[model samples]
Target: MLTLSIFAVLLLMLLIDIPIAVAIGLTAVVFFVAQGQSSFLAMLPQRMYSGTTGFTLLAIPFFILAGNLMNCGGTTQRLFRFARALVGHVPGGVGQVSVVSSMIFSGMSGSAVADAAGLGQIQHRAMVDAGYKPTISAAIVAGASTIGPVIPPSIPFVLYGAITSVSVSRLFLAGAIPGAVMGLAMMLAIWLMAKPRNLPKDPRANLHEIWDSFTAAFLPLMAPVIIIGGITTGFFTPTEASVIASLYALALGFLYRDLTWKEIPAILFTSLKQTCGLMFIIATANFFGWFTIFERIPDALITQLAAFGTTATGFIWIVIAIVLVLGCFIDGNAIFLITLPIFMKLCPLYGVDMVNFGVVMTLLIMIGNLTPPVGMCLFAVESFAKVGIWSLAYECFPYLIAILAVTILCAFVPEIALWLPNYVMGAAG
Candidate 1:
């Protein structure tokens, strides 16, 4: 009943349009005061500070900056050109390009909103020009953007590793195959719709064109290879990889001359704003997470689940259902921060592997960005889409199903997420 009331208040605050960070902080404050535990408020400052102090957490900002720089530095466009060269001639040509391009960009940005807002403009424009419907074009962009975080170099995976003390390198490796699976599934959906919907088909590029496009994107393309290789080879940590990624992106901005020195300030400012918002949420949500642990919420949940003989698979399904429903109403980061403590405890009891769960959880969280009511990717695409949110949401259904299928696959077949990590890291402890 206590947990119910706290969440009820949190949900009410979210419904009323309160900022996620503030809403969480306020809910904790209100409950503490009401319970005559206002003394806990004294630790607020310390807890919030300590929450943002994790070394792994340092990667978040650099990754965000790297993504911002890449977006502004001609990286996204080159990736799109290369993707189009490879698949632009297929049925649902432009749509296929959007998915493939997002997969490539995902390897760098590790952010759905970045992909949606940055690559999305190019994709939506290209699709519209190629004769796709405006609504479908927007949906394709929004849906494809979800692929960003599922690939390597993911911000969510970094945060999950920090919060859970899981291996960030393993998490990065774990995402590789599932991300590819998502791209392929989305492409298949587009292909199935091609004939009936009369999706456009562009002329295939010759070998020379493909070679030239790849060469154009070669440097930017190296971002992921450098990141994954450096980590797997024990050369650098994920946080260091983020710094290298940012530096590389900055170099590309100048080398290609796509981003001028004057643009650097604006790019840094944009990355700063995003990083600050995310950090604030982390700060407050950390306090809220502590409150849940203090109240023994995980203990209570474990008791209830045990009473029902819940299995690992059953636990995953429950989490998926909750995440998908709450995803419509809450930001993915908030949901992650608030529920992580409770979920982490259940992992061992249910025999679920943390590394595998990390990938699956990250995939589910990104799916939230494609959902309506507060879907960040939907709004990002809608900014240029000019289509009603509902219409865009409607069109995203097929791609959503495709992603959810991959998520379910990961949850059930742990090997899907764990195989690569185990192969490279010699199995996670």
Candidate 2:
């Protein structure tokens, strides 16, 4: 039972505040050591190197750099104005702006915490100043931030593609419809909650203002186009697209005159810092995945699950439930890296479509980001807004349900996740 023991050690390490990358790598080491497989120790370096050396993974650092550059390039204010022009007249004007801005920003950041801390704080302050309850404001920001990872250029999708050899471009297309549906669903939830509270509504933007804001946002808005369009049209690989996106973001910084040459070094350093941490986790998780395979965990799980009378849809529902429960206590990326190997292996056996499964898994794990106790976005918003975690979680419940409904819809109607991909990329195998 070395597998079980090593897993226990990993959980214990996390509970004791060990970093995930270290915990995972250490756990794998424990497995090998305890088994007296000293010979395998020599191969550790090679395994780690092989895991991180995938050409597809080269895209990660570039994308992270592109995101950092976009953030530093004065895109937020322009996008905020554009979102306000579009949705500031909705029932919950300030709150709707948070949702719409997140949708726009998600195309760039691909990060919930970044979205929550950046645009989220802006929306949170606005809603609070408009006399909304701090709890409600906190909930709106947290809920909308969940959209960050589901939109195009999501970092999580990149990780999944790197691990599973799925086409990153197809994964981007798969997220389009479901992401939009989620944004609309959250907006509807916002409208319903704010209707009872009589929240303030900003005046609808006239054509002139809307046009001006859109014009201002033009360069920043072209980011996803430059990245996605270039990748889809076969002009560049996803890796090359990231490099191109990074340069475009830098040029936009010069054009905007907000990001300066003097500040470039610090920005690169910060981006490098973040990328290194993620790359470590990816590397360690790859180590863990290798050991798990060596232990035949997937085989054991398949045999165990086979006896349960599982069918494709039934199995998906069960996986969703388990993922949701685990998500409450673990980081989403960790959860994804830890569980995807097992679940992805189950796909062909259950007759599940890998593309659809990847999309659904990404969405479901993100919904976990708003879950209570340890939801990353929840804590990030709570800390900044200074709202009680449970209080904000309570307010986010309805929105959580709205997200769950979307997850279920996308889960059953695979077309919700696959339609765009199939239409654009041809049928996935």
Candidate 3:
């Protein structure tokens, strides 16, 4: 009764528009109060501190800073030209460019919010300028932006690695194929819908134009290659890769003369603000996680599922459904931090492959970023496009289904998630 009550309070607060960090923190507080003890409340500070103290968690802010710097350094303009040069002749050319640009940006940012906010601004505006409906323009960008987390160098993957002791490198390799699948799928979906509408296309770029755009975009393009290559070849860890990314972006900012010394402090301040909010979520969610383990909540859940004779596959499907639904109302990382402890513990019993589980799990929760009512990506795109969330959600629905279908296929076919990692890492377990 007490456990259920805590969840009830949590869900109620989420539905009532409480900030996520507050909702999670309040839920833990409610749990303590309902437990009939102020003593349980005392554990909150320690748990919160421990949650954010890990060195691996440090990668989050560095990556965010790197992304912001690149965005501000005019990386988007170059990437856009390159994307348009390659795909602007395709059906729904502007929409196709949005999808392609998102895939390219993901390699650099590894953040859906960053992709949506930084690049989506340019992409969506360009789509609207191209005569696409504002809502549809926003929707296309929102759907494609989900790939940010699905791709390598993902912040969520790093968080998962830190929390569960999974190898971050393995997770990165695992995401590559799935991420590529999503990009290609989105483009194909665009083509089918685009040719019918006679969507506007850029005059096909001459070879010289393509070369010029590619050359101008070269350094920003190497951001992903450097991070992935360094990690894959064992030259550095993800944390070091993140630091490298920040420094590389800084270099390019100066090289391009797009960012000046006067702007440095502001960028750092913005990065700090974003990092603090994220850390607050991590801290508070850890308190909630602590209470969850103290109450043996995962055990309770597994036992109940067993009573219903839930098989391993059934368990995976059920988890996917629950996460998908919860995703509609909450943030993705918050969901991961809250629910992963329970799911990780259950995986062993169900014979779930941890690498595959972690990869598919990231992809599934990320879809929520594109969903309605509270999708972070949806709202981000909506703000700039000046469109309604429902309208954007409606337009985004097909692309959403396309990505989710790939996600389900990934869940059923573990090789899709594991083969690359295993082949690359030499038998990832």
Candidate 4:
């Protein structure tokens, strides 16, 4: 009864449009008072502080700064050009470029909205100017942006690792193959939809043109290689890699002269704001997670699932479904923080691999970012496209289906996400 009420209040708060952090924090406080345990309230500050103090989380700000720097440094345009040079003549034309470029940019940003809002502007304008429908263009950009968080250096992956004590380096490696597969699947979906939609095909670039674009984007492209390579080789932890990524992006900005000294303040301010918002969420989520554990919610959930005789595979599918459904209604990070403590408990009980489960969870969260009502990428695309959110969601259906297939594939085949990490890191301890 107590668990049911806590969830009911949380759900009501969310439906009533409260800020997620406030809703979560208040829900915990209100319940504590209701239970006459207001004395526990004094520890809230410490609980929130403990949550934000993880060393792994130190990567978040720098990664955000790196992405902001890259965005301002004019890296995105170069990536778009490179992707276009490489695949613009494919059946889907610029649609293929959106998928490929987003995959590359994903490595740098580790953020869906950043990809959607920054590179997306370039992709959207090109697609529309090339004669694609507004809705279709927006949908394609939004769909492609989902790839950002699935690739390496993902912010969500970082938070997941910090919260669950998983290895951030291994999580980064695990995402590579699945992220690549997602890009390929999206491109294939675009190809199949091309003739029917009559998607425009750009003239194929000659070798010289491809070489020119590649050279132009070369430094920007190295951002991911440096990050993943540094971590894999033990030269730097993920946190240090983020700092290196930021410095590298800053250097490239000055080298290209695309970003000036005047812009640095704004970029830093923007990154700070984003970081603060995320940190607050982490803080409140920590308290909420503690509340759940205190309420013995995980134990209760395990009891219920055990009664059903849930297998490892079955548990994974259930998590996927929950994330997809809740994703439509809530922010991905909020959902992740709220459910992860409980889910982590189930992982061991069912003998699931945390590394594989982490990848799968990250994938599902990316898919959620592409859904309706509160889909961050959708809003980012809609800001410029003027297409109704529902319409954009409808047009994104094919790409969503493509990504969903990959998510289902990953769920069934742990080796798909596990292989690269195990090979590179020599398997998790």
RMSD of each: 0.9, 1.9, 1.3, 1.1
- Residues 1-429 of candidate 3: C-alpha lDDT, one tens digit per residue: 655777778889999999999899888887677678668898888999999999888889999998899888888889998999998987889898998888888887789998998999999889889988777788888988899988888999999998888998999889999999998888888888886766677778899999999999998888899999999899999999999989998999899899999999999999999999999999999998888888889998888889999998899898899889889888999988888888998999899988889887888877888887879998888878888888888888888888888989899999998898888778934
Name the candidate that leads on TM-score. Answer: 1
TM-score of each: 0.99, 0.94, 0.97, 0.98
Candidates sorted by TM-score, best first: 1, 4, 3, 2
lDDT of 2: 0.83
lDDT of 1 by residue, 1-429 (tens): 888899899999999999999999899889999999999999899889999999999999999998899888788899999999999998899999999999999888889999999999999999999999999999999999999988999999999998999999999999999999999999999999999999997998999999999999998888899989999999999999999989999999899999999998999999999999999999999999998998899999999999999987789999999889889988888888988989999999988999999988888887889888999999999998999999999999999899999999999999998999898889733
What local lDDT does model 4 show for residue 180? 97
| 2 or 3, greater by TM-score | 3
What is the C-alpha lDDT profile of model 4 across 1-429, one tens digit per residue?
676788789878988999989999999999999889999999899999999999999999999998889888789899999999999999999999999999999988899888898889999999999999999999999999999888998998999999899999999999999999999999999999999999999998999999999999998998899899999999999999989989998999999899999999999999999999999999999999999999899999899889999888888889988889888877888988899988999899988888888888888877777788888899989998899999999998998888889988988898999999888778743
Show how many residue pairs clash in every candidate, following the order shown.
0, 0, 0, 0
The reply for model 4, stretches above 4 Å from the true place, is: none
List lDDT for all candidates, in order: 0.92, 0.83, 0.88, 0.91
Comparing 1 with 2 on TM-score, the higher-scoring candidate is 1
Model 2 spans with C-alpha error above 4 angstroms: 1-6
Q: If both were scored by lDDT, which would come out higher, candidate 1 or candidate 2? A: 1
